[model samples]
Every structure is written in structure tokens, then in C-alpha cells.
Target: MDATESTPILLREDLPGGIARLTLNAPGSLNALSDAMLAALAAEFGRLAGAPETRVVILRGAGRAFCAGHDLREMQAARAAPDGGRAAFADLFARCAAVMQAIPALPQPVIAEVHGIATAAGCQLVASCDMALAAGDARFGVNGVNIGLFCSTPMVALTRVVPRKAAFEMLTTGSFIDADRAAGLGLINRAVAPGRLEAETLALARQVADKLSGAVRIGKRLFYDQAQMGLAAAYDHAGAAMVENMLWRDTDEGICAFLEKRAPDWPR
Candidate 1:
């Protein structure tokens, strides 16, 4: 249902051990990236960026589908604006891109809990996350081309995660891939049974949250930063990161604990 003043566009739940769950709440629209939804996401992501206590984030949608992409009605309505909605369209896309970029920029690793369908920009959302776990029955696609609105923005994230040829085929054909196929394409970590999707995602979130938060934060930043560099540069950047990481007191304690055959007594 469309979100009324009494309903939230997005919902956040903080679990024990610093795991934060953000649910896209516009199920009536399949969590479409409407202007209000985009604004809510940006605001929540901004808040999370400063929340050092949040070690991991899991983004999911309420209702049957994860997301159905942009709201067609909202986009069509923008055409009523002066300038033929060109400026509005541009601003909308820019804001959406910011939210997508914020995923990797976050200190906490973000995991997408996907079910049902994630298409067009929704698929981009999945690809932008650090990792994803989808239900076996879930479907993914960048199908804007079928409507004459090529998913160029979504393509940016899609191409980075999946192979070039595969991305191109999906974009051109506007075909959806099942979760197993998506996992094989490296789009998601794995596909779990529909009944187990929530439990599996929460378990993975807790597993990551259980790690040393400082190390995970540093490593997450370096991982994305080094991915864009030349091999030699990447190696140099990674080596420097390792040096910085090794100097942490927790690292020293962890190493000592391993040698002593004891559980790591890392500071919380």
C-alpha cells in the first residue's frame, strides 16, 4: 500500500551485536524507488555512516518482492513539470546514484536479503551491496530496455558484479535470471530456500558482525578502493592496508591467542 503519514517509507531495526536491518517498507509498490523512498534511504544511510557501533547492515524488503525498480507512476508524473521533466529526471537519478554509492562507502558491510523479484534499479541495488543472499525462487533482471528506458544507471552496478557479456545479454533481452543463475553469475553469495531466507541472512549478518569491527571497517574500505587500481597499485595499497591493520592491538592479541590456543579476548 502507498505509505500514508502513519506509515514509514523505510524501517530500521537494530539487533544485538551491532547488526542493523533496514527494510524497504512500501510493499504496495513493491518497494519502488520513489522520490520519498529514495529520500528515506539516503537519510538512513547517512545516519548509519556515523554510527560506529553498527558493525553490519542487512537491507531487505517487506512483502513478497525485494523491489520492483523505479515507480513508473512517479516517473510519469514528473513529465508534467516544466522543462519536460529533464531536470527532475536528472536530479532523481543523481540522488539514486548517491544512495547506491553510499552502500560501499559505509564503514559497515551491507548485505542484501533478496526475495521474489529485484528488477531494473532494484537489481542495481543488489549489485551495489557488499554481498547478497537471495531466496531460491527470487528473480533478478535489468529490464528497463524492454520499456525503451535502458537501465544505464543500473548497468553501472550490474556490469561491475556480473560478466560483461552476461550483463549485456540481460540488458538487451530484458530477461530475468533465477536466483541460482544469479548466484552462478556472482551476483549473490548463494540462494537459500524461501522459508530459510530470513534466518540465513540474519545468520550471515551475525557472523560478519562477530568479527573485530575495526578490522572489518578498514578491510571493507580497502577492498573497494583496491578493486579500481592497477595490479601493482592494488598490491601496494593492500600491503599498506595490511601494515595498518597489523599494527592494531587487537591484531596482536588475536595472533597471540592463536599461538596460545585460546579464544581471542578482543575488546568490545
Candidate 2:
């Protein structure tokens, strides 16, 4: 269904070659991550975890921008409660963190199709993805410091993806980085002309979808698992993963096909 129809806050569209596109549709608030939007994303990612047919997922925002950040109005309204929104704020950030962590946890690779802007928690969302492609005019920042609040939550993912110095500069200065700058910072894979963003993103997604799904899934998991370990332990973990992957019939077929110069007839 289209964004205007079912689930206006979030829309899911499936395409050929197992690519699923999720659009954040709340353009009026610049696609802010409202409570409902976060819930929608969590539930959708839950479904995707069990959906083996979906090889890749593309997340984008509709209308003017990718996402501005949290819904400040919603957050402010919570302050009317007796506790001054402390409990509400805590829950909101916890939920947002869960949604961010779910991206790398999903079996399918996620590509952020960013345009216009991705700031604060929005920038964190891009960092959480396996990869990202932004429009040349797209912008990124963790500018919560500009309003007296530090972007501590977004900093978690930001620091992991970009260098510590670069992340610190953006976090402290509350400045925006252009798409090309973001690419250099390693927050995104690359930037393309605004008109070509979608095409280029889909091309990358399709290229990934063409790989052996089982191997890619293993590699994705291995990539993340090894990152948090000591060097020796990381190699041990990756070696075990390699052992499991090498036993897959498709992996054998891929190797044999390469030697024989024939297309692999991988089992479905």
C-alpha cells in the first residue's frame, strides 16, 4: 500500500529480487521519530527478522527530509505529567535504542536512502544501518547540543561508525555535514546527485541481493560479532563462522562454478 493509504506513518513496499523498502511518511514533522513511528519500525523489523524472502531492506523518508529527530512536541507534552517527563523520556530513548540495534541484528542488509537531512537520532539511524547512500544535497548532524541537550544517545552509534575525533566535532559543534563530508567521515558509502539517489541505492541493494543469501547472512553476522571482540578472539569467532559457511552447499557450488566457468545453480 502507498504511504497515504494503510499505515501513514510508515509504508512498506516489496520489489523484485527481494528488496523491501520502508518509508517514513510523516513529512509534516520532517518524519520525526514519534512514539508511533518507533513502534511501527520495531514491529516491521520484527517481521523482517523472520522473513527469509527479503534479501535487502531500504529505509527512506518521504516529502522534504529524511528525518529531523525526535518529536519535540510529543516530548514536551510528556512534561505536563508530575515527574517532569523523566520516565517518559527514559522509555522513549530506550525504545529508540532498541530500534537502532535491530538493524544490524536483522538478517537482511539495510540501506539508508537518505535525502534532505538526517540529524540527531536520524543520524544515529543511518549509522545503525549496514550501509547508506545519500543525495548530494543531503545533510547530517547530531545537533542536540544547540538546544542545550547533548546528543548522547545518537553518539552511541555515531562514534562506532565514524572516527572518535570526527564524531566529537559534530556532536560538540552542532554543525551539519554535507553528504560528501559524511561519506569521507564514513557515515555513508557515497553521495550521488539528488535525482540519482534512489537509483544508485537500489543498484547497490540489488547487487547485494544477487549474492548467496546464506553466505551474506553469515558474513553480516560475523562482521558485527567480530567487531566487539579482542583481535585474537575476533579471529577465533570469524574462523568458526567461516567453518560453518564453508559447509553450505551453495558455497561449494559457488567455488566449483568459479573453477568451471559456469553460473551456479544455487538451491532455493
lDDT of 1 by residue, 1-268 (tens): 7677898989999999999999999999999999999999999999999999999999999898999999999899889987888998999999999999999999999999999999999999999999999999999999999999999999999999999999999999999999999999999999999999999999999999988899999999999999999999999999998999899899999999999999898865
CA lDDT, candidate 1, residue 41:
95
lDDT value for model 2: 0.94
Worst 10 residues of 2 by lDDT: 1-10
Error of 1 at 235 (Å): 1.1
RMSD of 2: 1.7
- TM-score for candidate 1, please give it: 0.98
- The TM-scores of all predictions, comma-separated, are 0.98, 0.97
Question: 175-257, model 2: which lDDT tens digit per residue?
Answer: 99999999999999999999999999999999999999988898899899999999999999998888988898888999999
